[model samples]
Target: MSNANSDPLIVSHDLESISDVMRIVNREIWVVTAAAGNERGGLVATWVSAASIDDQTPTVLVGLAPNHYTTQLVEQSGSLTLHLLRESQLDVAWNFALGSGHDRDKLATLEYLLGATDAPRLRDCLAWLDCRVFARLVTGERHLYWVDVVAAARVHPGDALREHQLFASATPEQRQQLIANRDADITLQRPAAITWRKCLPEHLYFQPTQPTN
Candidate 1:
């Protein structure tokens, strides 16, 4: 039998090891929607987490790739709605993930209403959070937003869709497309990550100390 280390697909064995360790973490899929004036966009995202635990103040941290159209909308509007999809909402996930909002309107067919933050909230989600971006960090390939939860609701009673289930349920053609998209994104983002620069607001910026002999 051929050794696992000799696999042709293993671009970097070190990175592959990191990926293996990260797979143990639970990543729930979410649909993040944003609207800027007449423009609106949505995309499937997995990089969301609760940033604050204070009962009086709730916040969430979301990371979006800089290249996505939805990321542009979030930057323009400074607000977005994150939706937790039920297992039955795989179609919603496919719609947002498979197509680019730059090419066409992804929210055209989805039933939604404007939330308190002016972000488009999908009606069919298991739950939703309407958030306003209070702080942003530019991490080269990704834009990390710290958002205050302005409003939220639990709409339906169902198990939230997970990343593994979505992949298992995907058609063979869709699986191929998903893999292609993943590879394309990695190729596009790798360069940006390598040459990352710090860009922060005046209040958030600080000069790095120089090493001296």
Candidate 2:
């Protein structure tokens, strides 16, 4: 008899459940900024985490889409600054999230200063960290950078913006643009994910063994 869990239809349903669960998980919003010579770029991101526990040797893991202009700048400069926006800074998030830096200058209207890492550090953020990429892993659709935090500052004392808050605060036009951007990203990343999975060794994938009666 075939196991119910092994049914393809059930497996597909499980995947959908996983996606639904992910959608509800609250994550902090971050603005990752980078500059390479004359070119500067910034993008809204939610994938950043502490990589080291030691205060003396501060490090963070930042994930950026390989196709993003900010990611390209990080690659060229090996440096970036991460900004934690306040709850009232939805406009700042929208500015970076709504468009690509390759199409227009995202930082032209924003107030920022050159950080110690030489990345653009937005002045209006709740907090900011200047980091240098010491190592990186190029996953299929994302570039994971292990960065050393060289400088950090808490600019303003306020509630940090979260993903759910951002969504709730968006105007109708902003919400529509956000959905369009997400759909475009899904289109680009799906094939890349499949290609990456294909390249991985078959043995690396889990295969359930049949139980002996």
Candidate 3:
């Protein structure tokens, strides 16, 4: 019996569920935090859905479950911060996504600081935003944050953001370098395996060898 999910002939396209959609939407995204006011802790998130390039504030919104811990703090603070992940931040992005910082001192171990509005902005992030929450609109099971761009900081300039970045495809040069390094591996000091030529009929060869008695 074939599983219905893999049936491509099923004319109706069955898209991913909200959770499944989130798996794609929430990727190597970055947001470092330190002390949400008296909140005394930062909520790092990779599950953000950012869009709307034409808005006056150039809005980037994220949906959080109404019951999520960060949701309450964001609503109470009435503001939040967003950061653009840097090429060097592959580790930072993974740490927060894999673990929860709830009772732990997630900030003490990380390097960060308060932004213009006192929200946590990761020090290593390439770009930062101190946003003001204009509204907390409820969208089904999640509370959507509509933020106002109050302050902006760019740690790196001239970087392209026209498309989303992912780790699956490192730059071409990097991939080539990696493949070359792997093929030319020197871990084994012994010489590479010898390449043997194809064997032909002995009569076809004309070489003569002199044997010593």
Question: What TM-score would every model get versus the actual structure?
Answer: 0.85, 0.86, 0.56
lDDT (tens digit, per residue) of candidate 2 on 101-164: 9999999998899999999999889999999999997666688999999999999997899999
Which candidate gets the maximum TM-score versus the true structure? 2
Clashing pairs in 2: none
Candidate 3 displacement at residue 137 in angstroms:
1.4
List where candidate 2 sits over 4 angstroms from the true fold: 1-12, 201-213
Backbone clashes per model, in order?
0, 0, 0
User: What is the Å distance of residue 180 in model 3 from its true position?
Assistant: 37
Clashing pairs in 3: none
Worst 10 residues of 2 by lDDT: 2-11
TM-score of 3: 0.56
Q: Candidates' lDDT values, in order?
A: 0.89, 0.90, 0.57
Stretches of candidate 3 off by over 4 Å are 1-28, 32-34, 43-56, 157-213
Q: After superposition, how far is residue 140 of candidate 1 from its true place, in Å?
A: 1.0
- RMSD of candidates 1 onward, in order: 6.2, 4.2, 23.7
Ranking by lDDT: 2, 1, 3
Residue range 1-213, candidate 1, lDDT tens digits: 434754333446578688888887768999999999999999999999999889699999999999999999999999999999998998899999897899999999989999999999998899999999999987666899999999999998879999988888899999999999888888898666655533344665578989999
- What is the alpha-carbon lDDT for the whole of candidate 3? 0.57
Q: By summed lDDT, which 10 consecutive residues of candidate 3 come out lowest?
A: 189-198
